[model samples]
Target: MKKDIHIPVVEDVYIAIVNEYNAIYKTQDWNAYIINNKAVDLELVLIVTSGYSKKKATSVFRKKLDKLPKQSYAKIELMQEELFALNNTFKVTFFEGNQMFDKTYLFRENTINLKALQSIPLMAVKGVLAK
Candidate 1:
């Protein structure tokens, strides 16, 4: 008899949005939030990405999240310099009950719209959870 091992997978979890904000120093800042819409809890989540570029991708942000509860989110701040570029993407990886999950999200995707980002108010606070 052959034994079949069940593997867990992550679903309904994604890089919900990338938001821009006005800083006190007359500059801008950005925040990338990851939302977990599933019922299971994700552990040791790592969010990494390279800034927008047609030539070569540069590491803009890399951080590990301890845990993300169900129907919750984790936020990662992006450097002001990184916000100016609009052609980048994010790679999200995490573990769900010993099963590893990974996915890549583009900045221009339906989740994050370039046009909408440009029109946001200076201090306006918007997040994927609101949408």
Candidate 2:
């Protein structure tokens, strides 16, 4: 029976952490964003995020979006520099037409630093894309 079910593979959707300048604070900050590179619109987008380590953990955060247009992006949260020492996870789920898709993106410990940034799609700045 399990073999009869089909699970679609997720594509073109990514979670990225970008280092941006905060004009108000006059400092750079790390921020998380969800990028939708799919050709179709995403509906009822939901995301659950958290950070953890061997002896420490951060509170979980939930975010929702009514719709994410094709080739667009949305900011998820501001990530503190201290959190970079721990493993951060982002669980994203959304609907494309009548089908549902979900993906879990992880940024391993000490992996979200400026030295690892690259050109991210749908954004002007460079960032680290979660794996």
TM for every model, in the order presented, reads 0.64, 0.98
Clashing pairs in 2: none
Clashes of each: 0, 0
- TM for candidate 2 is 0.98
Candidate closest to the true structure, highest TM-score: 2
Q: Give residue 89's error in model 2 in angstroms.
A: 0.4
Could you tell me how far off, in angstroms, the CA of residue 10 lies in candidate 1 after the best superposition? 4.5
Instruction: For residues 1-131, write the lDDT of model 1, one tens digit per residue.
Output: 23675544446776644455456656544566777877888899998876655564565678899998877766765434334454556788899887888777666423344445432222245533212
lDDT of 2 by residue, 55-100 (tens): 9999999999999999999999999999999999999999999999
lDDT at residue 112 of model 1 (Cα atoms): 45
> By summed lDDT, which 10 consecutive residues of candidate 1 come out lowest?
121-130
Who wins the lDDT comparison? 2
